[model samples]
Target: MSLSHEIMKNICGYSRAKYSTWFYYRPDHILFDAGEGVSLALRNMIYGIDHIFISHNHGDHIGGLPGLIKSRASSMGDITKPLSIYYPEKDSQILQFKEYLDVSIPKLPFVLTWKGLRPGDQISLNANRFVEAFASDHMGTLSLGYKIIEKRKRLKSEYKGLPQQELIACIKDLGREAIHEEYHKNLLVYSGDTMPLDVSIVQNAEVLLHDATFVLGSDREENTHATVEEACELAIKAQVACLALFHFSSRYSHQQVKDKIYEIITANNVEIPIHYIYPHFYPSDFKQIQIEN
Candidate 1:
């Protein structure tokens, strides 16, 4: 299967101006952000989430953490599964939120861990896969974007033209390790609530979920979220394989969002598949909207 299909197979979320934003990637058991409706929308799926990555401390971003923790402790789902949540290091809002969770849900049925991560920090998902955090430009908050990477091994370029018999001989003489090198492949990138930043950070990602909080260019505010045009420009510059725009402002109609996205793609001659999370649709329905090339 394609990397996009594997990573986004059961992904679902909702994002609108001042409402909520959350994405659940079922394949990796990873949840990005914990907005208000997460616990209710995800329900039982919450049990499968092993790691939660918080982008910032905004209420619309981390509002559902307390409910999620409490639900996991009391719900019928497997309560013993280990869960780890990573948030921006040194952010007072998240620190205060954690304290609130502690006070509200004093005891839990499973192991709950909270870690502070800086822009360059990494969390290993498994032996071959990991997630990395990068700084994002979201107003004055300490926001972050995340990249999911898969490590792969490939034969060295020098050995590409060698005959099969010669390659076998090389393996016997130099050992397999000398003939192959490991490289990292970016599977997906999630830009949680941010204005335009360096596109190079997400270069060649199989899928990029970016903030497109504004559709009308004139409605844009300073040092805030990205406009639909800006999001597409970033995706184009980064050369990402697929783009999934989210966090649209509620002022525009669903038809408006679609029309603007189509207009931008046409103007730029963009060829990659594009998808967006419409404000009026439920998250479950959002997952059904296919991305077309």
Candidate 2:
């Protein structure tokens, strides 16, 4: 299987525009959003999440916080584990929701933290992995996109093409750091709910889960969401290894959604495998619909 396929196997999610959207990246124990039915969909797996990154304060994006928190506290799992939630700084709606949760669930068993983040802020996952926040255009309120980055080491340009023995000797004599340079690779980029992102933001990412709220360009009357064509174009321009479109509007049928995406991929000759989450009932299996061109 391709690396993208392997990565997708570990992720489970559900998205329906103006309704709900959530993704559980099992590898990192992170949830992107806590839309309605998230707790029910994940069931016992909800306790596995250690962190949640909220993109915006939209109801569809954050309606499940109460259930998720209560489930972690009272469900059939470890209730003492702490969970951290990160959101765009100064989001009033989210702050209000947090207050409500505090008032409603005063005696929580587990530690729950809510931290606001600005663009360029990062939360360390490990010594070499982190989640960084970036500004995104969605609503009047500040919204954010997230990128999961991993630090990797590569041989210095000057050491490239050197014989294996020579490289080994250089590493031995000058130390590994001296012979290599550190680079950041984007493991995943989540464009929560917004227009087509700038190519630079998602450049070379292994997987990009972008907003595809409209299948027909003419149907989009506002600039808040992206069309199917725009998402595909962004993926190609960014050279992302994999594209997974989500948050589709319910107006389009499953076949309509697939046809539009296929049209775009074929027109552009997009080589990366494209996947989509249709806007229907929130699926329990959460398998992404894959499209190849």
Candidate 3:
């Protein structure tokens, strides 16, 4: 195939204060976090996605489930592919979800799968893609983040001049599986909601969606959320290609949050481009702008 960037499609990640709703497209299908008004966004993005990933059981995280399931059923979606949900089987939240699925969406024409995730659990999604769920610092209930990645051989930039036919021949001679064993890279890491911690689990991910709720002491320790400084510390430590700061507290204005985060990360010599997810309450554009460097 010709060299082309994957069609990236993330419009919004936060509905209002402290809410997450995002749309991400991998090579296979679109993905999203369960949140209020997420169904409408998903419909606008792609026809019913086969896979849906939820971060936690907070109201903001799961409040959208009811509507989403109903909409799909009402729309007459023929979900031949099973909808797989990767979430931690914590408290009675699963029971609530089940009740919603049973009563609200009593006629689910699709198969649904659920699995209890723990630290070090790796979900090999496809031939060359994998998602790893690790322990997040967020408490109150079980919360998790995901790392999307390529588990195949790296393409050397030095081999650009070689024709594809030649490369195919070389691969055939050397055995494609043998070459795939070397040079794999992590592509993306998403921290649903968490305090600052070492993000080495997703080290070098091309994209990182991390929590940046507090900007200079916006919240108390009773509710732990990472400040801009802390978020940058984790990003700088992981050395990811890009950082998408999200889950902002209701306190800061859009400009105030960005300005505060940009200033601190810059001062600390954090060089990776930082992106922000605008809350729905903000009238500003949801377009996430990144730094030049």
Candidate 4:
């Protein structure tokens, strides 16, 4: 609900669906898909970022590359930290796209580190959170989804003044000697834009972000994408703690999609805590959402 922990600005949504962009900050500040002027928004707001992950090589996804490169060139001179980029590569599409950007923006002034995006790759940020990349289905281009895993550190507040090295040695010598014990860490999985697939990938996650582009009875295919009903089915199958639907089609209104999804799930007699990412909504318009730790 806060701006930093989980702020999803709908830079592009349910409007022409051409520029489908979103800046989601959960495990880290991630620029989902760079649409028109998205780089300008990031340059103005987001900070502490030296990496960029692209879901696909679509124009909407990589459109802002030139602008961002130019901006970086204009700002810092010869920055030590290179711009890290991750994108799926079935061929040399990612490389060619990057080369196009580089040649287009010759004055990039800084180093650019580009890497191939592979599925089942565990991505960790600092020591607090880790992100796992998975394959996603997008038209003719390669796409990927991300799962954010927040590792928990169990701190025993009662054993504050106790010895440090001795405690660890004692635990090694004596089993369960220490009072600290870490349990299952929290996880959040996001399916950028995909069709039906294995749900086991998100079994360890507490929250799931599903792509509910279309509704039921709409034209859906394995090669195409999922609808609202399809996303609900996947969420129900995964049985995750919570599910948030995103990436709706531009044809349907927000209210229409909301009502249709509710009706279909209810008709099927399945229930779960479902949330819609309504970026246009705020505390003044919609009631304050319950904050969870």
The C-alpha stretches of model 4 lying farther than 4 A from their native spots are 1-16, 75-81, 152-186, 268-272, 277-293
As a whole number from 0 to 100, the lDDT of residue 209 in candidate 2 is 91
lDDT string for model 3 (8-111, tens) is: 23333454545555545545453646777777665633334666666777777777777776666556455444567677656468667766677756657667
Full-model lDDT for every candidate: 0.87, 0.89, 0.66, 0.61
Q: What is the lDDT of residue 141 in candidate 3?
A: 72
**lDDT per residue as tens, model 4, 223-272:** 66677777777777877666667666666766776677668666776655
Flag clash pairs in model 1.
none
Scanning candidate 3 in windows of ten residues, the lowest lDDT window is: 1-10
Where does candidate 3 clash, by residue pair?
A: 13-21
Question: What TM-score would every model get versus the actual structure?
Answer: 0.95, 0.96, 0.80, 0.73
lDDT tens digits, residue span 84-141, model 1: 9999999988998898888889878799999999998999999999999999998888
Kindly report which residue stretches of model 3 are placed more than 4 angstroms away from their true locations once superposed. Answer: 1-12, 30-32, 44-46, 76-81, 154-180, 281-293
TM value for model 3: 0.80
Error of 3 at 267 (Å): 1.3
Of models 3 and 4, which has the larger lDDT? 3
> lDDT of candidate 4 vs native?
0.61
- Candidate achieving the largest lDDT: 2
What candidate 1 gets wrong by more than 4 Å, as runs, is 287-293
